[model samples]
Target: MAFLEIDSLHKTFGANTALHHFDMKIERGEFITFLGPSGCGKTTVLRMIAGFEAPTRGTIRLDGRDVTHLRTRQRKVGMVFQAYALFPNMTVAENIGFGLKVAHRPQSEIKQRVDEMLQLIKLPHLGERYPWQLSGGQQQRVALARALAGKPQVLLLDEPLSALDAKIRISLRQDIRALQRELGITSIFVTHDQEEALSISDRIVVMNEGRVEQIGTPLEIYNYPRTRFVASFVGTLNILSGHVIDPSTGRMAVDGQELRTAQTLPVGDAGKKRMLALRPEAIVLEAPAAGRNTLTATVEEVSFLGAIVRIRTRVKDEVISLDIFNDPNRRLPERGQPVALGFSHENLLVLEEGVQG
Candidate 1:
């Protein structure tokens, strides 16, 4: 049996629907992320799992026990919020021990658990400090420590690192993952940041408009997105219209240029206008070689983003982006300079032509 199961979950607030018929099964100790833009039901699902929001129509089972109607305190789940919901009046150690204290544990046991949690979060020296005295990252760690103090079966993180700076966010996320692994806890993280979800999660569930768009590992979602929403929302993609020439010969025309794809075309007749996707790294800003398709374009913009250089080029009427690793010895492309972009047929991804709300 799966460790956590959300079956046919549906949620609504008055006239509007927040989540629809969502279903997922997660194994024990696996890290899962609910990723999407705001109001896409990612948070709603997380709330339901944490027993904060009851589902309107489906049941939730954790460890094979039905928990759909349980209150937040009755469920064995710990949660950390994005706002660092630490009490201002309480000290760090007091905050961490609050959960244990509420359960009427012995004072000796509470102190021991509080000290252990402080050490685990590596803030043992600041136990006496209040939330207002701690740094943003430190306060968040205290929140995390407080959440874990109860030794809950599952930990739910609701965009915990969203408030920190980029460097601190990266560091804290690493710390959280390490701590989660060490404790072997089943966890669910909610985030709108694609890079965060891709980097930290064992699996990601992408949602939009109260519906799930795709669920897979980061590589699978990025490399072979099954839906147009998944393809466009996950990362930088070069989307364009492709006219089918001959399916048997694997021929197609994009931007008035002929190209070939090794992937099997969708069941369709000739002259079908299909949308195609390609990653920025797939195209090289150079002349085309054998077994590659070449597109003539003019450099429109060049952006040097620390470790990578993004070059935007105009081909016919469409703008395509290409990413290349930054090298000090190479010259940057100039605006209006004509260039050739080359890509192999297998690199092109065929996408269904539709809009996702």
Candidate 2:
């Protein structure tokens, strides 16, 4: 049996639909992320799992037991939100021990658990400090520690690192993943940040309009997105409108340029409409190459972005971006310089022509 299961869940707020028959299964000790933009129901799903928002339909199960109607306290699910939500009047140790205390645990047991939680979060000595005295990162850590104090069955994180700076967010995400692994806890993380979800999750569930669009490992979702929306929403993609031709020959035309793809093009010639999703970094710019995939473009703009140089080029009437590695020894092409764009057959991802807006 799966460690955590959300089956055909649905949620609505008056006239607005928040979730639509959403389903997910998380194995024991696995970290799954719900990734999407705002109003996509990532947070609504998390709230359902945390028992804060009851699902309008379906069941939530843990260890093969139904928990759909259980109250928040009865579900034994720990949660950390974007806001630290730490108690200002209580010390760090007191905050961590609050859950145990409310459970009617013995004084000695609460004290021991509090001490262990402080050490687990790497703030053993700062247990006496109030929330106002801690840094933003530290306060979030305290929030995490408090949630884990009682050793709940599952941990739900709702943009827990959204309040921290970039560097701190990265560091804290690593820490959270490490701790989750060490404890072998089933966890669900909700975030709009693609990089964060890709880096920290064992698998990601991409959502749109309260429905699951795609669920796969980070590499699968990023490299072989099944839909146009998933491909465009996940990362930087150069979308080219084209028509497929000759399924047996594996050939297509993009803006009058013939391209090769491993995928079988549409046969029977029913208009043969299709689209190609290409990554920016997959394109290689050269002076000229003897191939059909090469296109001459004029460099319109160049911008340095620390580790990479972003070059904008115009081909025909469309502006496309390419990222080149920064090298001190190499000379970059100046603005308005004509260049050739080349790409491999493997880099071209062909998908259905239609896409949802």
Candidate 3:
């Protein structure tokens, strides 16, 4: 049996729905992430798991026990908020031991746990420092320490690194992943940052407007997206509208040019419109080789990013962003330069065409 299960979880506020028929089975010690844009119900799922918000319908089972209607304190769960909700008056040690203190543990046990948590967070010397005396990263560390101080059954982090700067966010997110692995804790993280989700999650649940678009490992989510939303939202994809020439053979006509996909294509009319997803890195700016699809394009813009040169080009009405490795010896193409893009038929992805989540 799974360690935690969220079955048909639904939430609504007045006339607007926040989450819809969400279902997931999480094993023990697995790190899952709910990834989506703002107001996509990722945080709402986290809140439901944390027992801070009651679901309008469905059930949440933890370790074989249903805790959907339990109060926050009754459910053995720890939560770290985006904002460091540490008390200003309390010292770092006090904040770390707040949960233990609230549970009415012995003073001696509380002290021992506080000392252990301080060492766990690698801030043993800052025990006496107040929240105002610490930096943003330090304050977040204190918040994380407090959450783990009680040894809860599960840990929930609601955009814990959103408030930090880019450098600090990267560093702290790595630390959080390392800590989670060390403790072997079952955890759920909520974030809109695709890079962050791809880096740290054991499995990613991609949500869209209260519905789940796809759920899979980072590589699975990136390489084989099931829907149009999954393909475009998770990474940079060039959406090309084409007419199906041979649905069974996965052949399509784009800009009066021919291309094929290795994936399954629907059976329909020969001129039916279909959407295709192609990654930027899949195309090489070179002449067409044997058994390759070639697209003629004109360079519209060139962006010189670090370690990468992004060449933006257009083939008819479709715009494609191609990323190439930066080379000091090679001169870049100027705007309005004509170019030919080549890619394999296997790299062309067939996206589901219809209403997106």
The lDDT of each candidate is: 0.91, 0.86, 0.92
How do the predictions measure up, each by TM-score? Answer: 0.94, 0.93, 0.96
- Segments of candidate 3 deviating more than 4 angstroms: 354-357
| Collision count of model 2 | 0
**Residue 242 lDDT in candidate 2:** 67
Candidate 3 Cα deviation (angstroms), residue 6? 0.7
**197-227, model 2: which lDDT tens digit per residue?**
9999999999887888889999998988767
Better of 2 and 3 by TM-score: 3
Worst 10 residues of 3 by lDDT: 348-357
Question: How far out, in Å, is residue 309 in model 3?
Answer: 0.8
lDDT of 1 by residue, 1-357 (tens): 899999899999999999989999999999999999999999999999998888999988989899999988888999999998888899999999999999999999999999999999999899999999999999999999999999999999999999999999999999999999999999999999999999989999999889988889999889888677888899999887888998776788988888887767755748998778889999997777888988889999999999999999998878899999999999888999999999988788778544233
RMSD of 2: 2.3
What order do you get sorting by lDDT, best first?
3, 1, 2
Q: Over the stretch 134-176, how does candidate 3's per-residue lDDT look in tens digits? A: 9999999999999999999899999999999999999999999
Top of the candidates by lDDT? 3
